[model samples]
Target chain A: MLEINHLRKTFGRLVAVDDVSFTLQRGQLLGLLGPNGAGKTTTVSMIAGIATPDSGHVLIAGRALSGDTDPAKRRIGLVPQDLALYEELTARDNLRFFGALYNLAGGALDRAIGAALELVELADRRNDRVKDFSGGMKRRLNLAAGLLHDPDILLLDEPTVGVDPQSRNAIFDNLEVLKGRGKALLYTTHYMEEAERLADRIVVIDHGRVIADDTLAGLQSRVAAAGSPPANLEAVFLTLTGRSLRD
Target chain B: MPLRPLTAMVRKDLQLFFTDRRAVIMSFAVPIAIASFFGSIFSGPRGNAKPATIAVIVVDQDESTISQAVVAGLEQDRNLKVSRTAVDDARERVRRGRTSAAILIPKGFGDAAGLAFFSGQEKPALDVLFDPSHSMEVAMVRGILTAHVMQAVSAEMFGGRRGGELVDQTLAGLDSTSMPEDRRKLLRDLLGSVQTFYRQPDRSAGGTGLRGGLTMPYTVREEAMTAGTNVAYNGYAHSFAGMGIQFLLFAMANLGIEMLLERQRGLWKRLRSAPVSRLSLLAGKTVSGTIISLMTLSVSFGFAMIVFGVRIQGSLIGFLAVSTACALMAATFGLLVAAVGRTPASARGVTTLAVLMMVMLGGAWVPTFIFPAWLQQATLVVPARWAVDGLDAMTWRGIGVRGAIAPTLVLLGFAALFAGIASMRFRWEEA
Candidate 1:
């Protein structure tokens, strides 16, 4: 239930995201796929209200999101590209703080923190400081912090970028469970395999422009009709965006 | 604008701050250590109200009773610490800064000075060797030595055996001088009157005796000017105020650096993504920073009171008013640093230099009264100056709420100014 319509963002002379559009529906994972510096994060930032777009707007559940402290922002949980957890605080404390930001308190906040920790499979280590945790554990706690408020729409931006394979699989399983619970997720990643395995629909973009938007099979058919049948999603992405190495 | 989120942020910051044991300890330790050192220096060793004594070395080469009496007179003066040594040792002591000055009575000085007094010829002067660096002490010692030397020489000339011999010699020499007969007779009459005065047995009471010679015409009755209050100046009060304000700025500036770190580490972006407004976030930081600064200042002053006898001699409510305003000003200054800084490293360096300059100019290391008129007037704009002055009024100055109102209002004005600028300039994320 999230919509980004013709979003455009610029930094001085450089266009970070231009004429980009996407829709994330309930119980569906939409992968905004792109190579590095291809405006995936910028588009996610615009939809999450972290950055204002030069044009266009983001609508959450049919209401236009505006201003820095809009009520619509409470419906969207953003898992940033970086680990934003306080290293000195315990995992539970970090979750409690994030939960409180959404106005959750008392027993409700406690339950929210407990459920978020349980979902991330960090319940046993809730009292441990984030600094003492492994890179994988910190990434998981970072994901749990975003889900503490239980928002309808979750935005994950490269959440498993540097996580280990086990933690990545754990995060994938958590997202699958969230999708099963009717959560709308906007997952942005450059990895074709992650998009192929998780997203129901994929949107491939390059240089601030969307190149392809279709189902996995629909993308292969388009590649097949173009003369060369694609072997996988990677081949489909390469044919659509190009084979040039992105910085 | 929601209190839950704002309270959560403040709590998180305080938790992070207190978790670092070393930083917490150092935040309190540095100010107390520096304040105690300065307090001891200003208050003397035992906190007595006595002024500093000038150390002087006396080289008495004349074995006469008059020279001994001069040494005794200097020893009796409470202002000078007199010590006897050889001429060469005395010079070495003065050169080495071991003593402020040296008083040297040359050989046959008693006899020569006695002769000069009666004949009115050029008088033999005692040699003074002094350290160049201690010019003030040397000047004071010169004044004190003049009083002692005159009393001793005049006492011997008034009634001692040396006075009779010197008068006879002066009369005999008067005849040999090339002068008019009337003038010679006038000089002889003056010498004959001196001999007649020297022959009196009761000269010790009213003549040029030690107690009656070179006496001050007026006496000074010192009193503390505290607007009729009985409060006395405590060195620790000023020292604690100065050091407390200095370290509190450092501690608050660290809050700015912490904010910059949050920006670098992506926490700011994450927090901004939530429904929290920028005003709420900044207010959270200010609340936490102000609380921590208040704690730091309290610990410093508490230590000062326990160990150095510092007291708040004015209105207690006024003291709290100024202290709270000062803390709030420091908190807003921290926000200003974060709003203007580009990065944590550069912000730390620039804020450190800025804080040190402000503290120095505000007279944290020394009293503002010692500063030049231009510099003292220029420092009036610095917030630290107002903080220290306010604390001083609340402690030693014995100024009640009336005196505290201006400083508290000025500090709160600065707080509002910093908060306004920070709000206008603050960015949600790094540029």
Candidate 2:
């Protein structure tokens, strides 16, 4: 549902994202697998329309996204890498604010907020200020904030960076449910196991360029074709980029 | 722009600001406390309050009628709080700063001073001891002493029983001196005239037949200048205006820092990802900042009005115009700070310095009339000056809505300038 074509972004002398191309289809969870500073977040930022690419463009639902306030932007939801929730506000208020940003209001906004909170299992603590919540709870609330409008494509950028295993599993379950509802998601992460479990197809990026893009079996076949024994996503990454995924 | 998103953003900011109790208190309470403090100092005592008096200790070594009359004259003067004490006690009191000064009348001062006045011989000096720290009061005390001594010595010479003896003694001393003929003759004529005045019938003691005893030829009529409306000057009005302007700037600076923090914390990215325009975001922040500043100024001035009788004596519309414009200017200034500073810490420090300089130059701590001519003219560039002066005009100055036009226009001009610069330099994302 989201298409990024030949996206190139540069910051002065450094190239953050170069000639990056990807397509996130309906009911597909495309894991953008890369190490730190491998342009994972930069690619996600370009697709989400927060940062403009120096060349190329992003298309949402087969329509090119135009300027800052284009209606096409409404089809995409962004769960930023950091917990972007307002700490001073209650969880419900935070959701309401984000909902209002997407033009959601009244009973419809209320129902959407309730559904998102229930999916994240934070319905009971919705009245509590986000600052008073645990780290894992805050991460869940952050995810709920992006889901308030039920966009066609959800961009999850390292959403589980500092989450506990329980919260991580919960987030993975929520993403699976979203995928079942035919919501296309572009999830970026450095954790190979998270990508291995959630992503239907994986795109391995190294140094601002995609080196491998295939399913688990297809990627293993490519590794075997290259004279290396297929082990797991890590071995696949090590063979494809000549470096460990963590490195 | 769609109002829903902009409304949401402004509501969220105001919610966050109000939820932080310390921030809310800082926005409102600090200005009121400071304004009340300054008001009490600037507002002198009200109706029927006793006027301030200087304390004086009188040490009379001469128990003569002339010395007693001088002490009585000082006692009758309403400007001095007089007390009789021994020379040692008076000296100690003055040295310890208990009294403003001490007057020591020497022995035989009445006779010696009477003889010197007529014969032009050596003059008897009255010793004045004063506290070193209160040197300024010494001049005033000396002037009062001179007036009292002149009246007492002259009245005693003209009407007292010692007059005949002193005149006969002065005449006897004049014959033995080798003086210039014309000068001696003038001195003889003056003494002879004094003797003739003493011999006149129906001359009352302690009375020169003047309307008031020891009065100046004419008295000065004091009037306070206002905005041609005869409205009384209210110190609380000026204090509230000054403190309101100063603290409103502080509130806006804080809001700017909060905006910077939002950008640093990744909230800006989330906000931009939504279908909201950049203008909506900036407008939301500006609206919230302006609302907060207006509330702060209102509470401060409201407190002044209720407790201190400060009134908006001019056109009410004029006061509101200036107030609204100043608040908008302060809000835009916050945006400017956020756009210019690279980080929250740096922005806070620089904005604080700028705000303090503006407050000082704008005469928030003191009246602008007390500022030097060049400084007063130079401070016109600071927007706070217009805000403060505008409020003053609407309050004690009692000028109408016409007086508010220039200040309101100037403040709006500053707001536009700040908004333009901030929008040009604003970074939507961190570098």
Candidate 3:
């Protein structure tokens, strides 16, 4: 379970994340939807314990993340927007290193790495260097690295952003497996379809504030009640947030 | 802090270090290559590898025992090659630079030298004909000869088992009948104290030794720690130490740029997100950088030794301590660079300039002795100055543990200072 309570972050006068709050239950995936500069990354940063929130706090289970590398941080995994894998290292080495950060070692770390590689369909190329891998392979390996520690709450910030279709589908499949295993996840993406297909509940944020939070039908009905009968998640998003492009 | 993550982090960085061919070459191969280039340039010429000697012609016109002894002493010293010749021929040899200088003992010089040297009277000058181009060598040779003369004259005048007796006997004959009582008393007291001091050198050694306290001048003598040493100066050794230090500093500072690269690439963010303590991550990076720097310096000096016979001539432990201190200083320098510069591009530009300036000012290229007096003094502020001095002290100079202390302490202080600044200025993930 993950809880973000009224997190507010500001850089000078520009409010990056303002009064944003959300929660995800076990086995549920909450898709965080926002346009450019909508504070998706900022909110995830607070949850990942990388950035300090100006106000409010993030909690894993019932324990809040007070500072960097707290006990609560061990329960959370963050797959950043960038492929945060060491290009100079092999996939297995990358996984082993990330795994050891959570006190995983020996056979346990090895097994976790093997399971992660298998989950991401990268077991055969695990020994190959990440730099030598294709863009999709690196993306898959990045996802696998975050899963190496077996955290209860996984945060995927645009994990499929430059990945190929095959890798994207494999990533979706991996998330479904995590859901089946009763793990909580928060997936942020620009693709409305990814949110519609994978997320149990959708939370749409705009300009640092949560505009709408509901299931696919609940969001469609909300947008439809606003005088526009939206057909899908994309129309629901445009109707709720307006058609203006955010830079 | 958990060691597993620390170990894993250092392992990952070192693995990345070895895998990156450019980094590996820049770290190890570059320093060794540059050291080899300098080492070979200064190793020697035509397989001899022997330093050029200063030539001096000794014309013993006096032909007395003392004059012949002076000639023999010059011939015995290895630093100068002596040839007996006529006064005219000796002067010609000096003019042609075949000899650094000529020492011509004029007729009656030996007999007149002692009293004239001490009692302040005119005596025959030991004519020294020297070449203008080899002024430093000429000066060195003259200094040695002057010291030898002073030592020799002192022996002849007031040295030996009965030397003190000789002074006492001379004082016994002092004309108290004509001189004032106070003046005669002062002279007796002064000479008595001088006799007591020189005769009791062991006692003097315990008090005011290097402070120039009433000790006999010109007691400086050449002691050859290494036998059969043909060269006066080991050029290869100085070059190796200099080049090795400069490159090691450069490599260490560039390693800080590598950290900037990690930050820019977002890999540092991932590491920060891990359940690893910040101290562990920082310690891991610092340890890795220091280890790499130590390895780089070792490889460079090893090549210097194997290829050019440049080896440690001082205390081995002191040399190692000095080396570790330098490595620590360089690693902390990288940390400081990482703290100050936010981006790799800006860090690289600034660190390169700063490190290069340090190297140049530290006398890693030109010998510091050749620098202007003020510049040489100013270079004391540069950490690499201590590094080069430490290596040079441990090598060609053959200075003992005492010589290593200042450098080791200074470098360690620099390490702490840089590390302190870096810790103060650094943030794992700056918002």
Candidate 4:
């Protein structure tokens, strides 16, 4: 449902995202695992059409995202790392606003807002201003806002950052529901456990390149054959991308 | 195209605006407070049109009839209150600003006039010493002295001539045979007219004992549409309204900065991810800013009316048209600032400086009339000036609806031009 080919982005002297490539099919949850400054955000931002790449292309539903940018944007949803909800507006009002941006209105818009809020378990608190909400609650609302238009592809950029354990689990559970409903998701995170548990296919990225691309079990098998402790995704990740300060 | 999102954005902005109580007070209450305070000061004591109080010190060195008459004249003027003092005290009063002017009558024993009449010499002068810094007071004192001197000289001449006898002697002098009949007849007519004028009682003489003539050398008659209403075209009011309009435009910049923040926070990304077009998002922000500006302007004018007793003598529709255009221009200006600025701080710095400069040049703090001729000519480019002039022409100057139409059109032109530039330059996301 989504395709990227040899994506390259450079900022003056530095190559932020270099020779990156990946693909995701329907009902599949793909995990893009990388450390800080691994160009995970730059890659995701390119897919979301927020940033333009210097070379290569992105395709959503067989339509080139770089060529037909607006159509590609319409099919994709982005849940950013930060809770980008308007603090002044109520949750329902925020949902309504975003829903309308997708040209949803009247009864249809109202129902879409209601359903999105319900899915995030924030339906009861929909009338409360986001400024009054807790950090976890705000994150949930942010996810709900992206889901309001029910796009085919969802791009989540570290959605669990700063969230409590309970809220983190809730977000994982919600992703499971989306997978069950045949939705394709591009999830980026540094948490190996999260990737191993949720990703149907894992793409371990380091220094803007896909170093390892396979199922969690297959990636672990490679590490075990190399005299590792029947390594989990974490040991494999550490083995492939050495532990060093990235700042 | 998307009513729902636009409405939602506007609602969100209003919610935030109201939540920040300080912003609310600054936007609405501050203008009213300033207007009320300034209005009271300009309206004068108890709203009565009394002259501003000025002190006058009298140095009665002569202690003669004419000097006493001058002292009495100053006291009776109502605009000036005279305080009797010694010469030293009078000089101290003038120096200390306790008195605006000091009248020093020389001790001539009422002999200066007699000497001037008999010996043909200049009279002993009344020296009116005043603070040069108080030019208005100095001018007033000079006028009063001139009138007193004229009165004393006229009375002395009339007393010496005894009216009819002097006229008869003048006619006899003109009776020489060398004089042409027509010339003698013209002289006789002139004398007869002079005698008649002297015989008639002076209309201004009964109440004050001394007649007051025109004090100011030149008269400036303000020709306005309204004939009867003595509505002075207060440059201050025009300036206040101009500044008010410009500042209101600056408030719209805050709205635009908020829009940029929304985009950075992924609100725009999410909205774009929906079936909405980028155009719709931009439109929503622009509309919201315009609406807020218009509402602010309405509230400000309402406050102006209630506090300053300002009236709009032209068509209400015309006034609204100009206001709507100005609001649109302001909103467009905000969009341009947001498009150029990468962050809220940058936007604020640029907008604040830009708006203040515009207000100053647009004659918001000072009337364009007071500006240098070249500067006044230069203000034509300022949109704020057009807005202010449109309001003044429609309301204070009583120029009617027809007179405001051209200015309203100019404002609309600015709105269109600014909106076009902003739309062309605006970007939804940071590079």
* Candidate 4 positional error at A182, Å: 1.3
Q: What CAPRI grade goes to candidate 2? A: medium
For each candidate, how many residue pairs have backbone atoms clashing (under 3 Å)? Answer: 0, 0, 0, 3
Give the per-residue lDDT of model 2 (tens digit) for B35-107.
8999888866444455567899998999888899899999998779999899999989998889989999999
lDDT of the candidates, in the order given:
0.87, 0.87, 0.80, 0.74
Candidate 3 lDDT tens digits, B44-134: 4433445457788888888764566567667877678888878788877777777778888888776566435433345669888888898
Query: What TM-score does each of the candidates earn?
Result: 0.90, 0.85, 0.74, 0.81
lDDT of 1: 0.87
Q: Where does candidate 4 chain B have its weakest 10-residue lDDT segment?
A: B206-215
- For candidate 3, the docking band is acceptable
Which numbered prediction scores highest in TM-score against the true structure? 1
What does TM-score give for chain A of every model? 0.96, 0.95, 0.96, 0.96
List the lowest-lDDT window of 10 residues for candidate 2 chain B: B206-215
Give RMSD to native, each candidate.
3.4, 4.2, 11.0, 6.8
lDDT of 1 by residue, A1-247 (tens): 9888898888989898889888889999998888889998888888878788889878999888877788888899889888998999999889888988889999999999899989999999999999999989998898898898888999999899888899999999999999999999889887788988999999988889888889998888886755665669888888888888877
**Residues A10-59, model 3: lDDT tens digits:** 99899999999989999999999999999999888888888889999787
Tens-digit lDDT track of model 4 for B1-431 = 64665676666667677776776676677755664554545444332346676788888888765556567767787677778889998888788877789988889724565334322346577778888789877888787767765555444334323323444555565665365688768757876775665565663244332123223446567343341265654433554466468667767777778667876776655554454455666676677777777877778788777656677766677788778878887877777776777888778888888888887888766567868899989989998888888877766676767877887788778877776777777774322
User: lDDT of candidate 4?
Assistant: 0.74
Of 1 and 4, the candidate ahead on lDDT is 1
RMSD of 4: 6.8
Stretches of model 2 off by over 4 angstroms after superposition: A62-64, A216-229, A238-247, B54-215, B226-232
What ranking of all candidate models by TM-score puts the best one first? 1, 2, 4, 3
